[model samples]
Target: MSEAPIRLLIADDHPIVRDGIRGMFTADPRFEVLGEAGDGAQAVELARALLPDVILMDLRMPRMDGVTAIKELAKLGNTARVLVLTTYDTDSDVLPAIEAGATGYLLKDAPRDELMRAVHAAARGEAVLSPSVATRLLGRVRAPADPLSARELEILRLIAQGTTNREAAARLFISEATVKTHVLHIYTKLGVNDRAAAVAVAYQRGLLTLDNG
Candidate 1:
């Protein structure tokens, strides 16, 4: 006889996404949809009640974010494996969810088959990451540090906040020429040719994060 289907809990704030995923998984004989949650807080509640074998979690939610939910689940000593399914793969999103005890991370754009494989692996407590996310993690591991200096990071933050070079120079009380030079060095070090790309790469490398507050 075939093994029992993997019990699953689907969580996401979007109804369409939840319904679509539910439809896909419910049709699969190898999986069973135990329940659904609209947000992270609901996810935690349902998880506690259902004790599913796997949870398909979304990072962004209404009440409690996915990371906090994962942490709460971990705190409760819940062994259900969490596989993150979100539209974001930035460090701010990926790192926290992983740190909070996610067994895998897959972007929402992942192919249906790939997502199925990820869910299966997650049910087995195996690590899975989307191609882009895995590549970013590998690059971080290899480089292993904030490549830019403190000053560069500051400039990158300014750029991220839509600061012009002149404005950044004025804020730092530096000459525009010096600011331009720093921008060039930042571009080269980040392997990007422009300011926007530099700021993006900085966030990817964890050199910049969303507001701490």
Candidate 2:
């Protein structure tokens, strides 16, 4: 005999999105669309009754957010795994949902095959993450050294060349006030207070060199 299909509960604010996702699963015998929820609150309610293998959660819902729903499910000791499915993959969105016990994270842009695979993985209590989300998590793990932006680096290079903030602003053709803001950010990033100290730290970090010598 064949193995039973994995049951799914999709939760999204849009009826159209829920329908579209349901269609995807309905076309395949490998998965079963148990129910659709219009909001996180409804998702939690439906989950109590449906007991699906995986819940495809959306982060921003009207009644209760996805993260909150995941937390509630955990509090209730529900065995079903939560798989976050949304367009957002920023740190603010990805980290909280995972911390709330989401078994997987897939962006809305993911290919259909990947989405199905994500659901299957989630059903088995395995971790799933969209490429962008995975990259974000990896970046968090190996946080960058200088958090300095490209513009900030340009400003730092000018400072290394002994240019005043005004001169740098003039060369960059930006407002002096804007340049001051970049300078402040550079100082904060380099952990320095003044221009000279900022320059010293930049050289120590190999962000600058006395190329003239």
Candidate 3:
């Protein structure tokens, strides 16, 4: 006998985006569009009511954001796996949603087949990430194994504190060029692209602490 279609709840603030996602899922026999939510609060309400197998969540929404909704679902002991479907791929966006119990993260631009595959994987409680996101996260996962040097960590902490290269150089008694090199190395070791992402990832990975002022 054929298996039951995977039930889905799509939550996005934009009507067109919602329509597109709903149409895509409804066109496939393997999936069913159970409901659509325009904002995170409504998404949470629908999720509690419909109990879908997976929720395609958009991060930037009204009333509440996707990350907050994911956290709420977890607090309520909702079993549905959340698959973040948003335009954001930054460290701040990706890490918080995952830490909040998202089963997957996929960009809004993902191909239909890939999105389908992600939904299937999420329904099975498997973790999924977009290629770019996976690459960034993989760097983070492998970072602890390689470990950052002491100088790199010092520069990273200064970066986290909003220090410019020149300022960091002065603070550490190093040349500006040396500080810039250390910053780049810290970025490489943390699997991030800039000062903000580096700081965010560092906090996520426990490489920096809250009380380390």
Candidate 4:
């Protein structure tokens, strides 16, 4: 007995790129290329229809872009994990794709083996990134700057303690607007756009301690 091959959709504007990816996946017994689309709109439609397990998406495409496609797919409740395959390694491209719910990012020049590994990882709901992209993400995360003020740190401590912003503001005797400002500052300080990341950073840096009572 054997496990079924992972179904995949390849979405790229270049025929050569799509063909190359198709070849690579076909070579692996664990993967099956179920469909291919040359643009983002068609990709979205095919993904909705086919419901592939993974989507290999290129960032720049005609009619619609990969970021928009990823967002639209998520909005439509598509469960396929999008794995971005692009030539661009810039923060602008990477961040937007991740924010749009892409599960992975890989360079166009990635070796066949790495691409295969990324495909499998993305299929399992894991985030995969090239080493350079990982370095960039870590650099952003570790930059030493107290983007949060003293007041913001206090607010973050409360937040980590599971306090709502309104509750934190009430406890601290501050306005909700002031609490929001502190939260925004905390996000900036941690170089993260969300509360989960901010909390993780605070916990990692010993800025937030847990009471396991």
lDDT of 4 by residue, 52-148 (tens): 9999999999999999999999999999999999999866677778878999999988998898889889989999999988888788678765656
Q: How would you encode candidate 1's per-residue C-alpha lDDT over 1-213 as one tens digit per residue?
A: 899999999999999999999999999999999999999999999999999999999999988999999999999999999999999987657777887799999999999999999999999889999999999888867985536777877877888988899999999999889889989989877766787777766766667888810
Q: Please state every model's RMSD to the true fold in angstroms.
A: 4.8, 11.0, 3.2, 9.3
What C-alpha lDDT does candidate 3 achieve relative to the native structure?
0.90
TM accuracy, model 4: 0.68
Ranking according to TM-score, highest score first? 3, 1, 2, 4
Worst 10 residues of 3 by lDDT: 138-147
Q: Is candidate 2 or candidate 3 better by lDDT?
A: 3
Candidates 3 and 4 compared: the better one by TM-score is 3
lDDT sort, best first: 3, 1, 2, 4
Cα lDDT for residue 98, candidate 4: 83
Candidate 2 lDDT, 115-160, residue by residue in tens = 9999988888899999898998888678754678989989988888
Error of 4 at 201 (Å): 22
Clashes of each: 0, 0, 0, 0
Candidate lDDT scores, in order, read 0.89, 0.88, 0.90, 0.87
List ranges where model 2 is wrong by over 4 Å: 144-213
Angstrom error of the Cα, residue 40, model 3: value is: 3.0
**lDDT (Cα) of model 2:** 0.88
